[model samples]
Target: MNKKLVSMFLAGAVFLGTLTGCTQPANEGKQGGQEAVKVGMVTDVGGVNDQSFNQSAWEGLQKGEKDYGIRISYQESNQEADYAPNIEILVDQNTDLIWGVGFKMGKAIEEAAENYPDFKFGIIDYAYEKTPENVVGVVFKEEEASYLVGLIAGKMTQTNRVGFIGGMDVPVIQKFQYGFMAGVKKANPDAIVDVQYANAFNDPARGKAIARQMYQRGADIIFHAAGDTGTGMIEAAREEGKFAIGVDRDQNDLAPENVITSAMKRVDNAIYEVSKRLADGNFPGGTTIVYGLKEGGVDIAPTTSKNVPQEILDFVEAQKQEIIDGKFTVPSTEAELNAMK
Candidate 1:
């Protein structure tokens, strides 16, 4: 007697199942449309607040959040081993972009990029040999910036001797050294340029020791490319009443009296610009971006609150424009330096 009703109920159940299945894709589409874009960063071995490269990259991510309304997060890698895992964490979180900060992370970023082709990645200061389609390499014309600093060091040195302390022996650091030496040679042909490598980013003691050695060797001003190591050099400069140039961020605030000026990297600017492009669906991949003086990617800091002589400050400002306007070209290679001479 109830067969007709039972058959009807079974048909109703089939209809409901079909409707649920059809609604699933639309619901997924709606969720995807409403999802917020997220960006994450993994710092290099120097960690996030090194007052150097890592710090600069993190500053860019912060700016991206503020300007683009994207969610941003970061992980500071205390050791080299942490690079891949930290990037994996961001990928697992479904981050739209993961920035691997510094040359130390090149291998990790390369490996991760291969494993996740759809995930976008960017690294600062270095590039991979075999990078994925979604990866962007962000490098800098560091030599260009360092060359300007070298000019300052050459002219401002009272002892006619200047020094450069690098964090590691990488090509990136060498670019800074070579550029600086070239600049000094151009400005003061008689000036002596001493160079050394700390080999580690976190050792302040080593930085101080190197700076002291350079100072004792008759160098009056030292330019440091070391991360925390540079802090030690700045400290030594302050104690000895000499001058030290800062790097990456505007480190004039660290020791306002001793830091003559910082060779600005504009890492924050790079991060912000990259994230903005990615968020706008104009992601720049498979191309390496090299930012320099004209793009405002690098420059020297303004005279600090300590009041460097107005005359010297004015001269530096004028020189900055000259470099940007193509009037003065900084050399990066030994060959270029010789050519400039």
Candidate 2:
């Protein structure tokens, strides 16, 4: 594809148009209409069923299989130590492309890509300062989506106080928290946001404890960037008759009554697009691909709670458009958020 066509493809305008219609077997990996591609993934400690990014990435590979007849496989990591070995398993499987989900696997993906220089690799939530020739960094502007949802929390908070629960204090999760606080501050300067970290993405008990504490402290709504730990926050919100915001996927179904909405990062689209690129002989390796609001990479979930006013939703949509139009830029760091005031 030419430069203009490639730009349009990345922008999602021509993505579906560029896919091939060949009915080849999924295990073959080739370029120039030569062979089918086999894709594999390694999940983070949250596992593939975390109902978060990991699951989204796996779903994307499955989508590639359904749409383009590409083979797909994945290994679920039980802990941080399992990242490297799990990646090795995929590499040994002779996967045409290997995707490592989460920032925790950045180094592992790098090392694996280096060790197996002939293979292509991709990782989510990580942008390497010095990228490998065979690896692509797939990242998203999560703060933009978080900011949109933050508008809802700021507007709908009955007590003028909201809460944020994070899975860990890492940069990715911090981006979500900081953007959320910025949005709340923008929508309602007087709205106070309480922030806490579970330090573990899978610890639901800890998520519940912090969410409950925030609710007890006059917070009527809570937004969580934690993985499975956020599930506990959902349960807490439902039990306390409060509201909660979800992350990654559209988790409103988890507790439709209490979940106001969710900040969604489209990991599935990113993965599937990369897979298509590789198959189309347009693999984007040795660079970082950033999917932001303009690219439809992130947004608030469609499901809305009855408690949220339609006017508020309309206002959020306006803000989203403003961001895309370059009128507003969401903050992704503590200093940027502080400087905004």
Candidate 3:
């Protein structure tokens, strides 16, 4: 076994022992003195602190613990194969609700949900073809948000060449790529956009290599939907004195000077809301919830020193409203994006 997997297993064993007996809340709740809901999460390879959806999902658990009086714990997966073991450990701990924090864990979560029929499970970024009776799939209109940032990249690029780096070739990442590229083209029809896929979300070295190549190719601005890999893009932008856009969260602080903006996907809100439903005895099981710009599930980061012109900011805002009001719809697939042009 790999050292990282072994370490993750040991960590899971320790976490399981720690949470074994005390999975339920100690204090009696105001509602009929019932035990508090026990919520746990299993992270993807990115773990909990990747500063992406995994981190955002953990933050939601934290918020649930703080405000909703739910007991929370988590197990971090070191690789794709670790998803089942991590979730199974949480199940053994008697977690009432378990959240799998990435699309890659969809099958694992589904199997777990079936194996543990009494518990509720949630999976992010994936909607199963046939959701189990005890599962909810949470997804976002990531392309909608990415389109906004693409507009920024389109308007702000000094070299008339922009780029997009994706973590995986999955539809979720493709949404970010296609939407962003469309936005850039919408703003500057003549602009050139270069696209690449790192094929690994956690490989910062690969991300940096691709980002550097794009920068060298005269792409003054780059947008990355590569999770932790995107962090490498930010680093390259800073070193090369260029601009990069972040995804899933406001990552401007990663490189304030270089990160002009971020395409926000409110994974935290989705996690929190779903956890709340479970806690409130309103579990949205066997359902796929789609959150979009109108629901505040997707947006551009409000903070950062992009220093874009007021007109540009206003234009983006207007376009955002247009999207919400059905005046325009952002394409979510490569084929649709190509047809749009």
Candidate 4:
């Protein structure tokens, strides 16, 4: 009836279609100019609240969320079997990066990396062979940190005897023991170090038992790298009024009066740094990232204002700087141990 009016109606319909396309859910503008890149972490068997490696890794994720506006989430594996599934969940979600929090998850991470070559991954404490082009292996100079702790233990022991309790009899644990013994020897050659391993990450009872045995054997101070197992060591120290050193995190607050210090691994920092890189599109892949004293990856906790002598605190601070400056190298390998002899 009216050709011009029909043409105008068609034009209006085209305009409405354009508006609908612009308003589509997938094309709608995001709240923050860009969608937040999600970061996911799969924790080791000790879980995220273990107050150790898992806790540190979670802290890094939190830091990334706060600093870079990232979306961070985590899944704690209660069993070794859950590792692969948890990693798969993250990868399926299109997470920008997936962090595998401990050496125990190395195999799972390797599998996930191979299956999802386009996704980025970061694994702590171990590296893999035939790794995809999108994985970063993060390890630490734990022996160097443990050596410093040994020096402290050696110097502070009134009985000239100390003890070390490790979570497992792995090479990583050996590094801690060797470094500690070397540090003790460097500081007080006459001092004795009693070393033991619990062989489990979650057994606090075994840790306490070992610490009690060491204490009965004239050990005045004990250092534990046993994850949750170390909690029992601190408890033993508190009950007996002996000294205990923590690992991975600042556990001084756990048993304030009994815990002299902790061998800090700065796992939190490593996680945050990697997550930040991923957010910035600078994801580190096909490379191993080793953080140590110089990178603030490891150190001793601050001496609290109680029980710690001012002179000892000063000495620790001085030695810390020396280690950072490379003036003092802490022994880590069999050859280094032999050189100390």
Candidate 5:
């Protein structure tokens, strides 16, 4: 709600609060003797404490509660079967708005919106082919942010080989892979950008194994789009004395000696902004809102300077401006990436 906070995030500086177990609200925070407007979120399989977007989204909701006195709560889905049931829980609680936190929750949200015609629903990372008037969609241009970090990897890598590990093989993950690959190519054409997928967002052991494999194969830097799985990547980085690039949140603290930087996708800001819009009687139902480099939704972490050189930072900053100024497009798909070369 404060301009200063948003400015801090856009300027590549952020402080993420850690939240543990979360529960649905018990009708607290009354405004004028009436029950406060309640907002509920349903996270994907990564749960709320994945230290990724799910955690970031909850932090934003917590801020909304502090700034606007809105009652905020979240339901963590441990598996796909939990989605509809979680939405039902929020619906039963009479939440003013129900947010689904990932692309995987699209069908469940859409179904719930259709089932409960009077309620409002919003989703992240998923756009409906035909959006219900009561539902809103939010997506991001993650490729742009990943490209900046990839540029740094290309410039900083001693082995001329960088690796990318993804939680899933979805189009969203592809965006990160392709954009990172393109940025590496742009910076150093001879460098190789190795890519792999864990196929699960919470598989830390699997993620660790992948990172070790990449590092053993001469990759000195690795970027991960995996959720909790990425914690393992950062851990491996610390053990191997290598560099890891994080996603979703500023994760440098995970291994200050190892993690070089993080690709910050500010899901918290988006959630807070949307909640404020809702409080202001401007619920963005039936529309899709996209956040990108230009929209202050994504950027390289402030911790970048600890490892990346000034010239590389300046170069990436210029590229950021170039993207915002419409001077060039960062590839988000396989075909677009190939076209660049």
Candidate 6:
């Protein structure tokens, strides 16, 4: 493991107290007399196998299940309307803890938390200044990671033109967009970053169409923050003999030769840690945990060396250290990125 990853574990250690969020229910388990701690996950509209954001959260839950002897399952949301009903189903099951997988389900999670103060709930990609006592929110400085991969795009673009495809115009996706643009401009001021949004998170055909157009228009590299749609973009990269940067998790496995690298979020670790907390009897409710470069919450994926040069890797590491030490900040918004220009 990287030294920075170890720091991330220690960074979140402050919240591990004797008493926290939700208590385990009294339902009996097949193993010992102890009732198994049950964890239920509610995925956003992308479903559980989008090979991206939602999948990362489910990975965390599976790890927790193995390490903590907990019971875990997921409810897939095929559309926006599925959010509340899926959460309601989990609640009816008397699940010890429920996790909502994305920012799109924030409102539903918030309402469920409010309606059932006795039940514990958690969410990713969204935070609250003052949450209810039974809810936990985990957010990440995704821009920091996006910026790292953007540096690679800027340094490697043969045509001096790159592309950014987003799933939606949400703040969470914006962090990826502006951060990527910031790093590109910083590394190669003359480079052009063409940006567009799919307005949907699961449409691969649309993502492929956009990537094809960008590649035809002189972009040799492209980055996508659009969930399953990004999968199509990676496929397009493979077909076009170009490069694509993935988001949320390392997606090189999807197209090892085409995906140069990914802007990764340690979503799996975050979910595992929180699930363990719930099992241990301290759930840290009414709080939001924010992870950044310093916390190992976000980073450029390890596969970067597969395509990026050692010199660029060294530069990105130097920049990573600077961000960790508070010597610099990565822009997370459109206005902040514009200020850089």
Candidate maximizing lDDT: 5
- lDDT measured at residue 5 in model 4 versus the true structure, 0 to 100: 45
Worst 10 residues of 4 by lDDT: 19-28
Instruction: Assess the local accuracy of residue 139 in candidate 2 as a C-alpha lDDT between 0 and 100.
Output: 92
Per-residue CA lDDT of model 2 for 1-341, tens digit only, reads: 54334334432421243322111224455444655788888888777788877878888888988788788877777788767656665665578899989999999999888788999999999999998989999899999999998999998887999999999999999999999999999899999999999999988888999999999999999999999899899999999999999999888888888998999999999999999999878999899999999999999887864557889988998999999999888999999998885
Lowest lDDT 10-residue stretch of candidate 5: 12-21
Model 3: CA > 4 A from native:
1-32, 304-306
- Each candidate: what lDDT? 0.79, 0.85, 0.85, 0.81, 0.87, 0.86
lDDT of 2 at 296: 90
- What digit string (tens of lDDT, one per residue) describes model 6 on residues 243-338? 999988999998888899999998898999988999889998989999898998999989889988999999889988989999888998878998
155-228, model 5: which lDDT tens digit per residue?
Answer: 89999999999999999989989989988999999899889999999989999999999999999999999999
| Model 1 regions more than 4 Å off | 1-33, 128-131, 304-308
Best first by TM-score, ranked: 5, 3, 6, 2, 4, 1
Q: Which residue pairs show backbone clashes in model 5?
A: none
lDDT of 4 at 88: 62
Q: lDDT by residue for model 4 over 1-341, one digit each (tens)?
A: 44334435533543465311111011112326888778888887787788887888888778877777888777767778777666765665567788888888888888777777878889999966655688899989898788877878888899999999999988777878888888888779889999899988888898999999999999999999989999999999999999999999889888988988788899999998988887777987988888898998988776533656777667767877887898877777768887875
Model 1 steric clash pairs: none
Across 191-283, the per-residue lDDT of candidate 3 in tens digits comes to 999999999888888899999999999999999999888888899999999988988989988888888889999999999999898888899
Q: Evaluate model 1: give its lDDT.
A: 0.79
Clashing pairs in 2: 28-36, 29-36
| Local error of candidate 3 at residue 126 (angstroms) | 1.1
Worst 10 residues of 6 by lDDT: 18-27
RMSD of each: 11.8, 9.6, 4.5, 11.7, 8.9, 10.3
Compared with the true structure, model 6 gives a TM-score of: 0.90
What is the TM-score (0 to 1) of candidate 4? 0.88
